[model samples]
Target chain A: MKILVLMKMVPDIVEELEVASDGRSLDQEYLRFIVNERDEYALEQALLLKDGLGATVTVVAPDAPEVDDVLYTARAKGADRLIKVTGLPAGSGARATAAALAVTLPAIEGALPADLVLSGCQAIDDLDGFVAPLLAGALGVPYLGLVSRVSVDAAAGKAQVMKEFAGGVMGRFEVSLPALLGIQGCEKPPRYVPVAKVRAAIGAGGIEAVEASAGTAVAPVEVAALAKPEAAGHAEMLEGSAQDVAEKVADILAARGLL
Target chain B: MAGNVWIVAESWKGSISDATYEALALGRELADGLGVRLEAVLLGHGARAAAASLGRADGVLYVDHPALADGVGEETSRALAALAAARGPGLILVPTTNVSWDLLGLLPARLEAPLVNFCREAVVSGGGVEFTSLLYGGKMAATVGAGAGPVVVAVLPGVRPAEAGKGGAAPAVEEVVADFVVGGGVRWLEYEEPEAGDVDITQQDFLVAVGRGISNEANVEVAEELAAALGGAVCGSRPVIDQGWLPLVRQVGKSGATVKPRFYVAAGISGAPEHTEGMKDAELIVAVNMDPSAPIFSVAHYGIVEDATDVLEALAEAVRKRKG
Candidate 1:
């Protein structure tokens, strides 16, 4: 089975975000970009599948030429080949990107195409968690999101995945390829990519950039502005003794029916 | 400011959660900012009836099918995708609930929209909507924005109260009929509710909330005593919810239930965005912590820079004195 992992280069989410003077975007003066953290897990899972079943793995991402570093890392991590779509319009949102990729995927996958596609549940940056279903929809295949555990039978063309839901409940799902999966917390903790291997991948680079053909365009109603929220308000600490405070807090919780 | 606002009202068993209404309120705010009409798309059985109360949207697109009664992914996605294809909304808002989480990354890919999850606050400023999410386990806040297409965002439950219209005329509602195709290789086998007695915290009237500061499991009893004394409930942070110390429903944050209490006493919590966002709307907040720097203090109406366990015990004694 041919496995493809979709990855994107996103700004690190841990840093503080400052609005630009135009009030329309991030300041970008000191933004650090990196491969999405959860996507690394997706790559790791794809690699593990490849190692176990002797399958070919390919990594694709919609990004600029500068994202070659990501492609090289995928190759070093055991991807058979890497494809990056560069110079597609910048400032395109997820729908446009997915639409663009949907048009490109038929050709990218060809006749003997990927049997499975894996991606992180959500990029820490976009945190929208939309790519997996969009790709599967475009490709006319099945899609699963928020998968915590997965086991595949390449020969049987079936896979069992565990989904983590709120309140510690698990939803088990079975799917057949070609399918797209949006993976979140994993069965095992995400493995670390060795620094040496990353350096090596960075050095041995031969990444091909492919641009996507436009298709099925939809006109958005209006532009939405992005800005930070107003600073939080002053906390009104309820005064009293422990039991008194608890009662006060309890009264509040009870009033709200959330206690 | 580019993109029409989209609201996804989730349904299960032919009913919508209150968080869905709350998200509609947020959608109304976004629509106001964009100067576009709020559009709500309802999917599943009885979705139209459940969504009828969301009066803020300018248009209502309802898709009804029996397949959705069992949480049909294809049905839900197809319905949403079809609506999105017909009337493109720039920002899609969904309540961060179990059903929404199930859609997870899938919806964005289906609609080809960028998504933000666990968002607490969003405002239109520059040219796009910027969102603030919890960081460092809710210790801080991180704001993010997408430079391109339809943005899909999931706001944590209980982060914001559903905005109520104050004697204003209702907006016009437009319904669309579209055929959605559902044929993914997967099917829902069953929908299982968690085992009974798995959690009874939902019944607690007043909760003594704990966060990362309570490193020991035994220390939880300290909170229990305070809850007992106050005749309240014992609740926990998301970590505790994940750890089985508390039920998932009792977990406070975007992923957990949006709780509003007459009073909320947070002990040893740093008030991360996910947790704090849920409780900021509480009627009263009393934060207790050893570190004064904890963000919980910012939202607390009153606070004490002391060990929460010690303070809890002292407060319990004081309550006994005053009440007796």
Candidate 2:
């Protein structure tokens, strides 16, 4: 089985995110990016499948700041191929990224078409977890998302995937190969790869790059302004013992007739 | 963008979802603003009878098909696309949900239309709809201008009240029969309910929502005692549920249950956006954590910087004393 994992970098929320002076985009100065939380989980899932059923794992990503480090880390973590697609329209939303990937992925040289594609259900930046399904639509394949568990029967050209629904409902689905899934999580926590291993992967020669052909035509919504949500209220710090805070909370609740 | 405003009415497990009504409430205002009709596209199997509940919509486009029951994105998007292609809607609003999130991605690609996702609000501006979406979870909000074409907006929860969309004259129902062709691949097999049943956290009046700060399974008893004293139930953030400290039903987060109880006591949660999305609207929030900079304080009405267990124990005592 050949599995392709799509990953990307998003603003690290721990650092304060600032709106650009233009007010339409995020301020890039003094910003940091981390591998999207769930995409790392998708890579872990693909690697687990590789360890069990012997599949070749390829990590694909749209070009972004510090993405090369994320790609090298994926290789260190057992991904077999790393291909970065560049020249995507800067400042595009997740929809454009998905559209561009749909158009550009199939055109990459030496990267065989994948039987199954896995990507984080959504990025922290866009919070639009539709990349897998959008790409699948363009590729004319079936897609399932919010998947947590997966097992492939390569001989039969089929896969069994477990999806998560609201209220913790788990729906199992069977899909033919050449499918894509937006992974919500893996069966296990993502394994940590030491920095030494990632450095070795970089020494082994960094990732391959694919130039996005000019004028990829996915119409993206233009952000007119960006700002932090107005803080509704701040906590009135109830200091002293727990009983003091609890007493104050209970009094507040009682005042509101909730007690 | 020059037609009626349409909302994809989401029905699941044989009933209309609250999120659907919420979208309807928003759609009604947008339609009125645009001086066009508000329509609902209801797709389900044997679910056509529920159309009467969608009276806020000016018209109901109900389509019943066995394939529509499972909410497979391709089938749903195809069915909606076929109908929209024929009837030219100026704006479409879909609630961003598990049932419809897949199509939020698929429909835009197939229609070649721009999708505004994570959308929180939309208003009439310059004779067009401009949207505001919460990006990077909820840290940053972006205003999106609708370009010169029909656009689909995925409305977020908590924008408009579902109550406003509940009562209206029965809408005219038009049964739509459209072709829903899909790749013969993905098929829903079985559904596993969460750990039989515990408590429907969504219905709770008071919630003691613990996070990773609780530490271990044994510590859950501390929360239970606190909840008992407060005459409420115990719930947790995703980490506590993922750790098996609480059942999935007791989880309060984006993927779990959204709760706006009368009183919420948060402990040890760093307030990730996913978790905050579910419970930020609680009537009153009291947070306890050691970290001074924990984001939970941002939404909390009261806070105590202390160990969760120590605080929980004291809170229980205080509540017990107050009740006694």
Candidate 3:
């Protein structure tokens, strides 16, 4: 089985984010990029499929700063192939990214077309969480997203999938092969690759660069302004040690007759 | 140029959701700005009666079909695309919701229109709609404009109050026959609700909510002890739920359960909009996080910059001693 995972690099939220002077994008100077958390889960789900079916897993990512390290880490984690789509415009949203992949994935040299495509249900960057569906629409295939569990009925050319929805409600589905899925998570946490193994993978192989022509977002929406969420009624900060704060909390609850 | 503003009214199990109403509120504002009619496109099997609540819109384009009963991505996308193609609404505003999540990714493509997702706000400006979308999970915001063409936008909740979208004179309803054949490539089989938990967190008067900052499963017990002493319940944000540290039903978030408790103690949560949406309505909020910069502090009535587990335990002891 051939499985492909679409990956995106998002600004790590742990670091503070600043709006650029352009007021349209995040200030790049201080921005730290990492593989989107859910996409990492998507990759983990693919790795699980690889372990079960001995499937060849190919990980693909759009070009972004610090993405090569992430791709290298994926290779270290057991991905068989890495293809970075280059020459795309910066800050392309989910639609443009999906559109580019739909065109570029088929054209990667010497790699078989993926029978199953997986991506994070959504990335923190756009939070559109529509990459899987957009790619499926572009490819004219069926898609399911917010998926948590999967088992392949390779003999029947179908897969049984579990999708968790609002309130943790789940629906089991039988999706035909050659479909796309937006993976919310896997049964287990994503494996951590040590720095040494990632370095070894970097020494062992180089990523294939696939050029993508599609760059512009079809939505002509331009970021007109970017600003920190204006602080609404700011929290009245309680002073002192943990014990002091706790006493204050207890007192307030008592005053409110909540305790 | 197209002349009408439209929102895709999302429903599940025969009831309209607050997300649909929320989108209607935004739709009303956008429609008023453009001087056009606001319409709600309701799709479901036997759902015309549900259209009555969407009185904020000028009209309801009700499409009744068995295929649309479940809001399947393929069927609903095609149906909405066909409707938009026929009527050419200036803009199609969709609430970013579970029911419409699948279609939002496919609808824009089917309609051959641009899409803005994770939208917090939108307005008709300079003869076009400008959208404010939350990116980086509310860490950053982006402004986008849909230029002089039909656009599909997936709006986030809290952009407009749900109450603002509800209650007006009944609107006219127009029945539309969907034009496309329902395709089945991804088919549904069965739905499994969450296993019943020991308690319903939604009904609690006070909720001690832990977030990712609580760190691990071992820490969950600490928060539970605190909840017990405080005479409340232990709930968690999505991270804790996703980590299996807490039961799904005890989750407090947009996708889990919204709790309007009398007092809400948020520990270790960074306050993603999804998490905040559920607990923000709490009458009193106390946020405890090591990072004072956490967004939870913004909504919190009182903020404590401290380790959540430590503070929780300390608070639990304090509450017990005070009661004694």
Candidate 4:
């Protein structure tokens, strides 16, 4: 089985976000980029699947010199090959990315026909949480989203996916081969890849290129004008000595039945 | 006028969601911008009553049936598609929720319209709407344009406050029937409500959020104590929600309800932006963390570099003394 993990580069949220002069856009100058949080899990999940099934793992992402480190990181995590698609815009939304992939997937099929595709449920940046299904539609393959568990049967050409619903509900689904899946969490936190392995992969790079859709234009749903949220109301300092504070806290907890 | 603004009201188990009102408010804004009528297409049981209360919109069309008491994705697509054709609107808005997320992409496919998922903002331009969405994980804003046809947008819940509608008398409830079919692949097994704590934080004007810095689940007592003393609610970070320590509804973040309380105090929360965005609209932000480097301080109007357990104890005592 061959698996592909789709990754998107996003701005690091730890950094402060500056609104554009118009207050409708983000100021790019203050932006620092990293792999989207959910996409990181997607890549990690793909690598785990590769290890479990003795299959190959491939990563496809927008090509940028800055993202060379990102592709290397994927290789360190267990991807066998990395394919880069050029001319995709930075910080593009799910519709644009899915639309582009819908066009690009056919070109790469000759070298690597992906048996399965994986992505994070939602990227931390956009968090619209719709890309996985949209990509599945573009690929004309059965897909599942918000998956907590996934398994593949290479012989039967089938895959079982367990998805998450509200209030701790779980739904199980089965789909045939050449399908797409989105994963949410891990029983174990993702394994971190060492920088040394990533550097080695980059040095030995044999990167391949692919085509992407000419970008489509998006319409505004509303103009986003951001203001820093107002300050919280005054907190009355808990009075008295340390013991008094603790006692008051305990009494309050007991009254609330928290104690 | 450019086009009628349309809202797809979502329903589950025969009842509509509170976010539906937020979507209507957003739709009304779009419609007002274009100087066109704002219309809503409600699909599900009791939809007519919910539609009746939305006096803010131009009109409300209902597609009520027993089949909709349970969630029906495919049927919703048919109803929305038919409504779009009849309305001939320039833009359509739907609440971004679990059900809507499942049905969002299908609408564009069904109506042959351009669908933009999770729109954060929009502006009317040249009879079309230009929308802004945070892409690549909230790092940068991506702007897109829809062509001449209706631009369908799914909006994140809790982004805007509910507002009064300015057009056509509260929408008259009218039922529309269609050849709608529910996909049979999935069936309802059972329903169990999450174990909700005694308090609903969303209803609280005062909220005390405990972060990882709190000593342990046991130390949640200190936070809860503070909540009790102040007559507020106790909330937690993703870990608390993920651990099932609290109901999923109580979680505050990008996926959870965007909240705006009069007073929001953070104890030990390092305040990841993912977490902060949910409470950014709060009236006041008081952050108490031992680590001065914690990100919560940046957004906090008042910051105290002290342990959360200690601050919570102190604040709780102080409030109690004041009340006594």
Candidate 5:
């Protein structure tokens, strides 16, 4: 079985974000980029499928300085191949990215025996959570989102997937092969790869670059402005010793009749 | 030609969800601003009655089908696409729920329309709609404008007052028989609830929730003791549940149970949008986290920037002292 994983690099927002002078985008000069949180989970899910079913894993990601390290790390962590698509404009929305992937994934040599495609359920940067479904629509395959578990029946050419619904309910469904799944999490935490192995994999140099064709399609949505949400600023910060804060909390609870 | 603004009402188990009313409230504002008719589209088995509940809408496009009742994404998207093609609504508002997310993902591609998900606010501007979406998990907000007409938006639930549209005459219902196929590769088997814990957190009057910042499973007892002292239940964010520190029933987040407890204390959660979406509606929120910039602070009524473990220990101790 051949499985493809779509990963992305996003701005690490641990620090405070500064809106650009244009008021429509983030300032890139001081920003640091890292692999998206859930995309790591996606890679892990793909590797799990690889281990269980003896499938070949190919990882694909948009080009960025951080993308190289992510790709190298994927290679060290059992991914068989890495393809970096370059030349796409910055700030490309989820739909455009999905469109490019749908076009580019099929054209790569030796990438085609792909029976399943997995992507992170949502990118912290976009948060639209539409890429996988859009990719499935572009590829004309069934789409499943927020999937937590996946198992394949290679002999029957189908897969059983489990997804979480509202109200803490779980639904299991079967879909034919060559489907796309937006992975939310896996059964286990993603395995860790040490830095030395990733460096050695980088030295081995199996990374391939594909120039993404320009002008696929413009994103329907255009950013009008970007701003920090107005802070509520009403929070009464309880200061002093931990015991004092705790006393204040207990008093509030008592006043509310919760105790 | 200007088109009507349509709010797609989400129905579950033969009733319209609160999210649908929220959409109606938002749609009324946008439609009135654009000088267009605000309509609602309901698609589910026995959805007409639910459609009639949307009195704020000028009209209701009702599609009754069993396949829609369970909300199979593909079928629902196809049905909505068919309705969009026929009616040509300028802006289609859907609630940001699991089903709507799935349907919106496919519908945009099928209709080749732009979709903005998790929007907190929207406005009509220059023959199009501008949407404000929370990004970086609500750290920053971005205002995006879609081009021209026929754009779909997924509005964040609980942002609008559902009561704004409460008092009005029943909307005129128009039955729409759109052409779409229902069954194919995907089939829903059954709904299995998460394992039940000793207390149902959803119905709790007060809750003390923990997150990964609590460090490990052993620290969960600190939260439980505090809850016990306060006569409340203990819940945790997804990671805590995933770590086996708490059962799925005690999990609070998008995939978990949404709660509106009278008092909520969030200890150590970094306030990811998924976790906040479920508990932000509590009457009062108290946040304890080492990071002062944690998004939970944005919605918190009171905050303490301190080590969560230290706060938990002190709170538990204070509760014990109060009981004594």
Candidate 6:
């Protein structure tokens, strides 16, 4: 089996975000980028499939310094190949990125004959989670979102997947091979690769670059402004030690007949 | 076509969802500002009746078909794409639900139209609409707009209050029969419900909700002990449930159970919009978090800047001493 994982690099949310002076986008000078958390889960799901079915895993991501780290880490963790798409602008919308991938993925040498394509269900910055479905549409394949588990019947040429619905409902479905799935998570947490193996892989140095053509996929959405949320303006902050605050809470609960 | 706004009414189990009404309320405002007719599109088994009850729209375009009962992605996307191609509304508003993700994604790709999701507010400006949405897990807000063409938006639920439609008479209902086939390669199977938990947090009048601030599964007991002292139920945010510290049924968020308790105590939750959407309606809210800038403090009536574990133990001890 051949599986293609669409990966993304996003700004780490741990550091504070500031709106640029233009008031339409994030300030990039202080931004630090890392692999999106869900994409990590997608990589893990692909690796699990590889372990079970001896599938070959190929990863494709937009070009960034952090992308190199992710590619090296994935290689150390058993990914067979990595293709980095370059020349795309930073903070491109999901649709534009997916359009570029549609043009680039099939053209990558030895990347065709893919049996399945996997991506994270959503990214933290996109207006909506549109990449996987858009990519599926571009590829003219069936698409499913919020998938948690997947199993394949290679001989039968079909796969059974567990699709999650709202309110904790899970549905099982059988889809044809070569379909796209937007992975929410896997049964197991993403496997961890030690620093030494990643370092060695980085030193080995087999990163391939693919130049993405400028497509007609333009970002329909524009940023009018960015701002902080308004304060609630009604909270009465308690000041004191934990004990003092606890006692105060107890009194209030008692007065309200809650204790 | 260039001056009209359209709302795709969402329904479940043969009844319109609250999200549909919320979209209609916002649709009314957008329609008024643009001086255009606001039309609603309904697709289901009993869509005509549901469309009549909307009352706020100037007209309704409905497709009543048995195959549309479940709102499957492939069928619905094809049908909606055909409709949009024929009657090009300036803006299409859809509620941000599980199904909307599929429809919004496919319809835009099919038509190559601009789309946005998780929108909390929208306004007519610059010959288009400007949408305000939360980003970076609700850490910051961004306002986005599309150029003068067909744009699709999925409005977040619970962001706007539902208003009664102009309620005088039923609007014109036009039946549309599109040549879209259902059931491509995927089939709908039975839904597997989550395992039942020991306590149903929805029925409780008081709740102590723990978030990632509790740190680990072991610290969940601290929140439970505090809940026991207060004679309330224990629940948590998505991270706790995702970590297997609590059952899925005990989670409180947009994707989980929506609860309206008389009193709510939130510990360690940073108040992402997804988590707060389910519990922000509580009669009284108290928050305890080490971060003073946490968004939960904004919605909380009482705020405590301390470690949740420390606060939990102290509160439990205080309750015990008072009872003794």
Please count the clashing residue pairs in each candidate, in the order shown. 57, 1, 3, 30, 0, 0
Which candidate, 4 or 5, would have the higher DockQ against the true structure?
Answer: 5
Instruction: Give the best candidate by TM-score.
Output: 3
Ranking by TM-score: 3, 5, 6, 2, 4, 1
Q: First chain of model 4: TM-score?
A: 0.82
Give per-residue CA lDDT, model 4, range A178-203, as digits (tens): 87777675444467778888788888
Q: CAPRI verdict on model 2?
A: medium
Query: Which window of 10 residues has the lowest lDDT sum in candidate 4 chain B?
Result: B183-192
Provide DockQ values for all models, in the order shown. Answer: 0.20, 0.59, 0.66, 0.14, 0.63, 0.62
Summarize candidate 6's per-residue lDDT along B144-257 as a digit string, tens digits.
Answer: 777765788878777566655335378889999866767656655667788775677888898999998989888899988878877888999877876778876788875577
Report the C-alpha lDDT of model 1 over B152-241, residue by residue, as the tens digit: 787876555655411134434455665666666876655445576644554455667887677667878887887777787778775565
Residue-level lDDT of model 1, residues A124-219, one tens digit each, is 334334556766767878887767567888778888777655544567777887778887645443455687997888777766667788856343
- For candidate 3, the TM-score is 0.95
lDDT, residue B150, model 6: 75
| Candidate models: Cα lDDT each | 0.67, 0.81, 0.83, 0.66, 0.82, 0.81
Candidate 1 deviant stretches above 4 angstroms: A44-57, A61-92, A103-112, A127-129, A193-227, A236-259, B1-8, B25-42, B46-62, B80-98, B101-177, B192-251, B254-324
Q: Write the per-residue lDDT of candidate 3 for residues B1-324, one digit (tens) a residue.
A: 356998998888778888888889999998998888999999888889999999999999999898887777778888888888888888888887766778887887787687777788887778677787777767666777767658788888777889999999888999987798686587878888888757888889878899999888999899889888877889998677767787777878755787898989999999888788788889999999988778888889999999899999999899889888
Could you give candidate 4's fraction of true interface contacts?
0.09
Please tell me which predicted candidate would have the highest lDDT against the true structure. 3
The residue ranges of model 6 lying beyond 4 angstroms of the native Cα positions read A231-234, B46-49, B163-171, B181-183
TM-score for each prediction? 0.66, 0.90, 0.95, 0.72, 0.94, 0.93
DockQ of 4: 0.14
Candidate 3: regions farther than 4 A off? A110-112, A127-129, A215-219
**Can you give the lDDT of residue B173 in candidate 1?**
49
lDDT of 6 by residue, A123-153 (tens): 7787743789888888888888778789989
